[model samples]
Structures are given as structure tokens and as C-alpha cells.
Target: MSKVTPSNIEIIEIPKIEDPRGNLAVIEKEVLPYQVKRVYYLYDVPSSAYRGGHAHKEQLECLIAVSGSFEVVVDDGASKQKITLNKPNKGLLIPTGIWRELENFSSGAVCLVLASEVFDEDDYIRDYKQFLDFKNQ
Candidate 1:
């Protein structure tokens, strides 16, 4: 796999359909760069809390704010960038080998994550120093 960088993270715009009742957005494996294998979400985060302080060795993910907003900080050993997710129809594509942190969540914010692989503890780079070492390798 290629090294993931802050500049390579893509913002994907999901298709939205307007209706009298409610708005709907569609996300499918066919529309993304990788096939979806797992899905999860984060909600009810404390105002002072943060999440996601690691990188994946092989897993790729798309993070979407289903409700409210939050900031995602991504790092690639050398540089970092902050991205805000406020729309349900937009997602941030996080490739492998890039460290990420989620913070500054608004009330009622729901972060939905679509992953490219199944849950595997060995695939996670949870330590910052280890992540840097892995990135250098």
C-alpha cells in the first residue's frame, strides 16, 4: 500500500435526494475507492472529550458527520491538517498509515464511520511513537 498523507485525504460528496418528509443521502461500496467491510458511529461525546488517536496499518475509512459537527485532525509524520465534518452528505476519506484524531464536537454530533476492513486489533497503530516508526518504514 502507498503511504497516506494529509494532502491525499479526499472529501467525498454523497448524493443527496430532497423530499418533503426528509432528506436522504446514499453511500455504497461502488461509490467509494474501497469496499465497505465495517461500520460504526460515535455520539454523545463530552464537550471536553476526544477520540481516534491512532492510525491504521491497512484499514481505510470514510468519516461522516450525520448530525452536528466535529473536527478531524490527520497527521502523516511530517505534517497535519484539520478537517471539519458538518454535513451528512459529505465524508472524509482516511487512507491507511495516517494518524487521526477527532475533537471539538458540537452537541448531538454523530460521527459515522465506514471502514474498508473488518475489526482487527493487529491492524491498529495505537501508539504515536509506533505510528511514526511504522510510517518511516
Candidate 2:
């Protein structure tokens, strides 16, 4: 497989049909473009001050700003990348083992995260320093 990066994080735009009456969006399995094994949303969040400070050992994720906008900071051991995610129909796909932080959320922002694995704390490298060291190794 190819390497992953903030630039390659893929700003996927889901198909949206707009009309004077309403709007509609669709997310097809594996066409959201990956197998989505878990789904979660982040809301009612206060200013990060500090947040997400971790990396996943094997889990992959796709983050969508379904309601508003926010920023995602990712570190790939030797380098760091910052991504701005907005637009309800767009998303960011994060590969395994990369450190990620979510912040700068706009009011009423609802972040939807789709994972490649089910809930498992052991897969999470929650300490920033530890993540860097582990990733480098």
C-alpha cells in the first residue's frame, strides 16, 4: 500500500442532491471508501485546551464534519500535519498509527468518526510522547 499523510488524508465529498425543498447526502459502504466497522460522533464539546492527544496502533478512521468545522492535527512520527475539515459532505480518512488531535471546533460542530475496528483501549496510544516513540520504532 502507499504511504499516508495529511495531504493524502483524502477530502472525500459525498454525493449531495440539493433542491428548493431540502437536501440529501449518501454514504455507501466501502464507498465512503472503506469498510466502516464502528461509528461515533463528538459533540457538546468545550474548547479542547487539550484533546485527542493519541494514536491508534491498528485502527483506521474517517472523520466527517457533519454539522460544522474543526481542525485535525496529525503526526506521523517524523512530521506533523494540520487539516481543516468543513462542509457536511466532506471527510478525512486517517490511517493507523498516526497521532491525531481535534480542535478549533466551530459552534454546533458535530464530528462523525468511522472506525475500522470496534472499541478497544489497547489499540489506543493515549500518551503523545509514547506515541512518538512507538511510531518511530
Candidate 3:
């Protein structure tokens, strides 16, 4: 497998439609690189709590803050980067093989996740040392 890095993650601008009531953002067809097989969300998370302490082996995901805000810390084996998601019209695309940790969630924050694959326990790498070894091999 090819090496994955924090730089591999990209902030995607979702198309917006303005209206008299409220603005609308859409994600369909070409907005994402892969077909979405699953959808999930996190809400009402405590600010002091942490989530997403694993990396996917083959699945890719796009995360969006549809409500409040949060921080995503992405790491390759060599380096790491922190990304803030505060806009509903923006989404962070995380490719396979990068370890990710989600933290610093604002009160009432809602994080929506679009996945390219269905949930499978075997696809997750939950240990950091094992993630590094997987990267090396």
C-alpha cells in the first residue's frame, strides 16, 4: 500500500444555494470521490471527551460539522496536523490508512460522517504502534 499523510486530507467546499429562508449546501454525485456506503453522526458530545482513535484499512470518509464545531487530528506515521471544522459548507476528506483522533468538540456540536464502505471491525487499526508497523510494511 502507498503511504498516507496528513496532507492527503483535503477540505472540500460544498456547493451552496442561497434562498430567502436560509442557505443550502449539497453533497451529491461528484462532490465525493467514492460512493457513500454508510452514514453516521455524533451529537451532544462533551467538550472534554475524545473520539475516533483508529484508522481505516480500506475505507475513506468525509467528515462535516453540520451543527457546531470540532477538531480532527490526523497523523501519518511521521507527522500530524490538526484541522478545525466549523462550517456546514465544508467537509474534510480522510483517505485510508491515516490514524485520526477527534476532539475539542463545542457544545451541541454535530459531526456527520460519510463513509465509502460499510462498517467492518477488521478494517480498523486501533493501536498506534500497529498503525506505524502497518505503514512501514
Candidate maximizing lDDT: 3
Better of 2 and 3 by lDDT: 3
Q: For model 2, how does the per-residue alpha-carbon lDDT over 1-137 read when each residue is reduced to its tens digit?
A: 23347435666777788989978878887445567889999987675543588889888888888888889888887788888878777778787878889999888888999888999999999888898788668
lDDT of 1: 0.91
Model 3 RMSD vs true structure: 3.3
Give lDDT: candidate 2, residue 15.
75
Candidate number with the higher TM-score (1 or 3): 3
lDDT tens digits by residue: candidate 3, 1-137? 12234657888888999999999999998999999999999998899999999999999999999999999999988899888899999999998999999999999899999999999999999999999999999
Q: Please give each candidate's TM-score.
A: 0.94, 0.87, 0.95
The lowest-lDDT stretch of 10 consecutive residues in candidate 1 is 1-10
Please tell me which model should have the higher lDDT, number 1 or number 2. Answer: 1
Local distance difference test values of all predictions, in order: 0.91, 0.80, 0.92
TM-score of 3: 0.95
Best by TM-score: 3
Instruction: Name the weakest run of 10 consecutive residues (lDDT summed) in model 3.
Output: 1-10
Model 1 vs truth, CA RMSD? 3.1
